[model samples]
Every structure is written in structure tokens, then in C-alpha cells.
Target: LPFWNKGSHSPSNHVIVAFEAYRQLSQVSIRPMTAISSMANIHEDICATAKRKEAAVIILPFHKHQSLDGSLNNTRNDFRWVNKRVLMLSWNFC
Candidate 1:
């Protein structure tokens, strides 16, 4: 799934990333379902999407805290919490 960054510094980059990911996955014969949302509500959006789509798994990227340039830092205090929440919520679906 793709998370939409509504007020991000680089919004177009997110689209490019999503498209590239879709292309690579398509090459492997794996079609992925996608969704978009702001970083703040991504956890809730993911859980809602999973329920709506009846998804068994959710894959998240570290891009939330790290940029495409591979810089690693704690950009958001809730990043860890969001990760944990997504993992726990996905497990409940499974």
C-alpha cells in the first residue's frame, strides 16, 4: 500500500516511489492494493483499508522516518508507535 503525504515537502516524489514500486511488483507477477493518507493518520487509514479490503498483510516502509536518500533519524516521535500499531492491527486481521 502507498501512504499519501498530504503536506510533505516532496509530494511528487511519493507518487514516483509508488509507481516504481508498482512496476517492480508487477514484474514479479504480484499485484498490490494501494492506499494513500497523511503520515499523521496512516495507522488508522491502514487499519481501515485492511478491513475494507480484507487484507491479510500490510507492508510498511521505513520512509516515514527515513527519506529516499537513506538518511536515518527520528523525524517523528509517533513513528515507533505508528509502526507498532500497524503491526498489531495487521496481526489481528490475520
Candidate 2:
């Protein structure tokens, strides 16, 4: 499950397994987010927190998309809002 987190933009096994798990589980909310912030450092913090928490629903590819900054930054921010107690329990990907 932890293998999905490769530290950067590359799909890990954990992400695939997590996606399948989500399909089977059907109750958990899997939300994906980008990895960017206005200050860049804040984005790094968000990413760090997510890594610490073993986040699920990771942003894939990390490619140059149109809304990459906005989406990922928001998701990271949202993940930060609830990272204290919540456990993602899923794999990650790039």
C-alpha cells in the first residue's frame, strides 16, 4: 500500500491498489489534488503533510496541466485542514 508514494510524479503500485480498493470499498471519498502553491513553500508543506499522513487520492502524472497550480494547491490545503486525525490508508502514485 505504501509503495504508491514515489515522492514525485510517477504512478506507484499503491495508487493502483488504492484505486481498486476504492472501487471495492465504495464508501470512502477519494479526492485528487495538484501539488502547487502561491508561495511554493506552502505547497511543499502541504505535500509534506500528505506524505506524513500517507495520503490517498494522489494527483497523477504531475504534468503540466492548465489548472495544475490551482487544483493541487487547493487539494493540498484541504488535505491539511483534516490531516490531523484522518487516515488515508491508501496507496499513492505520481
Candidate 3:
């Protein structure tokens, strides 16, 4: 396994960490759970799935890279736009 540097601002590494954490948590939690495996067109897919299943809450993870100085370095513009749109559309249900 590749090790990430402490306070690394790598988006891919962050995603890997997030998924692993979620996996571990799911194993110990007794509540029912579902994992969406696809990443293609994620924004659209998540919205469609939520609407179809009438999901109570949709958790969207935003990607951000922080520098050693504790300032945000690179932020994902695509995710930012998608999150905004999804929040707007889901307002009625939320």
C-alpha cells in the first residue's frame, strides 16, 4: 500500500482514505447500508438514484487539497458546481 505524507493535499489519496474509513465503519455499524460503486457521471447518477429511491439524505463529498500552512490549495470546481446544483434541486425534498 502506498503511504501518503502527513497533511498531504492529494485528492486521490483523500478519496482512498475516505472510502477505507467508510468501509471500516460499515463493518462495525449494525444499521443497513448501501455503497454506490460507480464514479462515472457521479453527480447525475447520485441525483437520479436519490430521486428514484426517495432517499432521505444524500451525502456528497467535496474534494479539497490543503497545504501544510493549513490553507486550502486546490478545490475541485466540478464537484463544487455539482454540489450546488444538487442542493438546489433537492431543496424540496430536504
Candidate 4:
């Protein structure tokens, strides 16, 4: 899962092509799982997916991007709350 990956917000075709190249050059299998959910259900959605997949760890979305100056920034502060809720809901797996 891409939790605010460097290119998660980029064009899908760009990301796909990069992944394809990486997969071929490295000869490693890459399976991607993607889902779109409303903000209201985001935490629940992530928790459910993690449980269903029996994931050992859930990388809560950092929801910030690094600037050229090496600083992280995001306009939304509520993302912190959502991240906490996701971690709380998935605590069992940890």
C-alpha cells in the first residue's frame, strides 16, 4: 500500500510505468492494492484491509510532502487525528 509515497499523488500512468521498470530491472514481483474511500470511513477502511490481509504493519498515511528545502508540510491538521484513529483501530495486528 502507498501511504503518501513519493509518487502516490502523481499521475497514475507515471507511477505505473516506474513500477513496471523497477519490477523488470529488479526481477521482483510487485503487487499493488488500491482503494478509494470517503474521509469519514478512511480509518475503518484501512483497518479492515489490514486485518483481511493479515498485514504485520500498517503504515499510517503521513499526509505530508517534503519540500525542496527539506521540510515537511501539509495544510490539513485533521490528518493527524485520522492517522491516530487508524493506528488505534489496527493496534491488534501490531
Q: Each model's TM-score, in the order given?
A: 0.45, 0.26, 0.47, 0.55
What is the TM-score (0 to 1) of candidate 3? 0.47
Better of 2 and 3 by TM-score: 3
Clashes of each: 1, 4, 0, 0
Highest TM-score: which candidate?
Answer: 4
TM-score of 4: 0.55
Model 3, runs deviating above 4 Å: 1-45
Cα error, candidate 4, residue 21 (Å):
6.5
> Compared with the true structure, what per-residue lDDT tens digits does model 4 show for residues 1-94?
3333554456665666676677777997655567888878888998888788876655555668799999988856667778978878776656
Write one digit per residue (lDDT tens) for candidate 1, span 30-75: 3365577787778888888878876655666543456689977776
Best by lDDT: 4
* lDDT accuracy of residue 11 in candidate 3: 64
Residue 91, model 2: Cα distance from true site in angstroms: 14
Residue pairs in collision within model 2: 4-92, 10-94, 34-72, 61-94
**TM-score leaderboard ranking:** 4, 3, 1, 2
